[model samples]
Target chain A: MGHVVIDVMPKTEILDPQGQAIAGALPRLGIDQFADVRQGKRFVLAVDGDVTQEHLAQARAAAEKMLSNPVIEDVVSVRVLEADGR
Target chain B: MGHVVIDVMPKTEILDPQGQAIAGALPRLGIDQFADVRQGKRFVLAVDGDVTQEHLAQARAAAEKMLSNPVIEDVVSVRVLEADGR
Candidate 1:
């Protein structure tokens, strides 16, 4: 079996309160190396066979249409998952 | 100038209701190539300078200690964002 990975992130212009909360809390954790934080969603879709080009297309469509809200989120990426599970 | 990407996913044995919902809805959209779906979180931490080994270490620490709940989730990856934005 194969899997397709889809990444969805808030649009740059959108306000990400979750990310802001993380950024605010990081300093308390004594990890102040980060300047900003953005939190998003990742999804893996399992297929019955190797992830073909058609699977990618369906994943992209699903990402744009169902997985993310286009008005506030962007479908950042849609690709086949690597064998090593990257 | 660079960013570290962290990926967190629900443990394999855990129940992912959100992913289940998505998987249940896919066939409604006439995209039934997928058999299962798993959902997770992706975080981007923007840094002031290059993403060094120190930054990766810190990011990994943050990912484990703050970004994910060890009981229910796993920090699947912590790496520097690619220049091409992959």
Candidate 2:
């Protein structure tokens, strides 16, 4: 089985309210000196197959179309989490 | 400055509707090899300090207290994103 993880982050130009909220909350909780905080999404996928190039391609397609928004967010990368199903 | 990322995911016993929703949607988009999928949150923090052990400790403290819900989610890890302001 192939396992993959996709990281999706908002574009730098985009205003991320969720990120802002976290950034604002951090200092209040005593983690001072943080400049900016960006929040994103991570998806872990478990597929019962080998880690072939075709598998990677399909994963990319699915991530681009569904996991992230193209307008304001970017699918930073797709990483192979595991190959031996561990 | 030190940069850190925290990954938070639902506990194995917890019901993750978000992950199920994505797994269900993938087949509709034609990538049917995926069996199960788990969704998580990634926080990218840009802290204005060095990447010392103390920095990591504070980051972990902040993450555990705010970024994750101890009841149903777990803070999988705290990773350093960068150093030397890059």
Candidate 3:
């Protein structure tokens, strides 16, 4: 099995009100130095395959279809972790 | 320089309203089979150093202090990437 890590973020052109709200709340939360905070989503999944190029492609497509909103968000990165063969 | 990827997620014991809201909205958004969706945050930062074990530790601490809420969230993972030495 392989582990896939997907990072999704709002498109830069889209207005992220959620992120803005979080940024506004940060100082009060005692995290003052951060001038801004953009909220996003992270998914870690175990796929039934080895970490190959094709597996990565399939995982990316799965993320695009189910895990992220293409209209407002982008897949920032995809990482596949493989186990050493015995 | 190195790139540090931080994945932050709510503690399993805590209720993630945002994630629940997203999960509730998914079917209407055309993603139907997903029974749940847990939302989290991902941060990618460029640090000026080699990807040493020390760098990873420091990055994890920084993420805990500034980027994540230790009370309700945890730093799931930290990965440091280094460029080829020139």
Candidate 4:
């Protein structure tokens, strides 16, 4: 078994309305020092079978294809936690 | 400076279409062993000023207020890293 965490975010040059709204609300919520907020999506996957390099590669491809909009999003970050090897 | 990581997830009882779709598509993408995928939100904040309990409290409040949907989401987890304290 293994756990994979993926983060998807809009490109830096693009305008993110969700992020803008959150950034605007930060000060009112008492976090005045926060200069910006970039909204993103996170996915946590629980694998039931063997964890292998091929599995990780497949997971990454799956994320790129359906989990995020690659056109607007510039970065896709993945972290593997609690894998069978370690 | 400090870094804060927040994870927000939908309540277990609620139906997560996004998660469902991803889970369904996993096998076709070659991640056949993934039993499920839970969609969530992650925010990484870089604090420029003092690192204090009050600052952490304020950041949490900000996340709850604008970054997460408290009504549908049951979990909000925060982790502080690279704080000035240590």
Top-scoring candidate (DockQ): 1
- Stretches of model 3 off by over 4 angstroms after superposition: A1-5, A10-40, A43-73, A78-86, B81-86
Over A3-48, each residue of candidate 2 has an lDDT whose tens digit, in order, gives 7777789998999999999888988889876688898988888878
lDDT of 3 by residue, B1-86 (tens): 56656678788788878767755665564544434445678765444554567656755766777778899988887775323200
Off by over 4 Å in 1: none
lDDT of 1 by residue, A2-50 (tens): 9998989999899999999999999898899999999999999999979
lDDT measured at residue A46 in model 1 versus the true structure, 0 to 100: 95
Of models 1 and 3, which has the larger DockQ? 1
Worst 10 residues of 2 chain B by lDDT: B77-86
Q: Backbone collision count in every prediction?
A: 0, 0, 0, 0
Q: Score each candidate by Cα lDDT.
A: 0.92, 0.81, 0.63, 0.69
Best by lDDT: 1
Please identify model 2 stretches exceeding 4 Å from their true place: A82-86, B82-86
iRMSD, all candidates: 1.1, 4.7, 7.8, 6.1
Chain B TM-score of every predicted model:
0.95, 0.87, 0.81, 0.82
For candidate 4, the C-alpha RMSD (Å) to the true structure equals 4.5
Please tell me which model should have the higher lDDT, number 2 or number 3: 2
Model 4 whole-model lDDT (C-alpha atoms):
0.69
Per-residue error (Å), model 4, residue B65:
2.9
Q: TM-score for every candidate vs. truth?
A: 0.97, 0.88, 0.57, 0.78
CAPRI level of candidate 1: high
lDDT over C-alpha atoms for residue A62 of model 4: 74
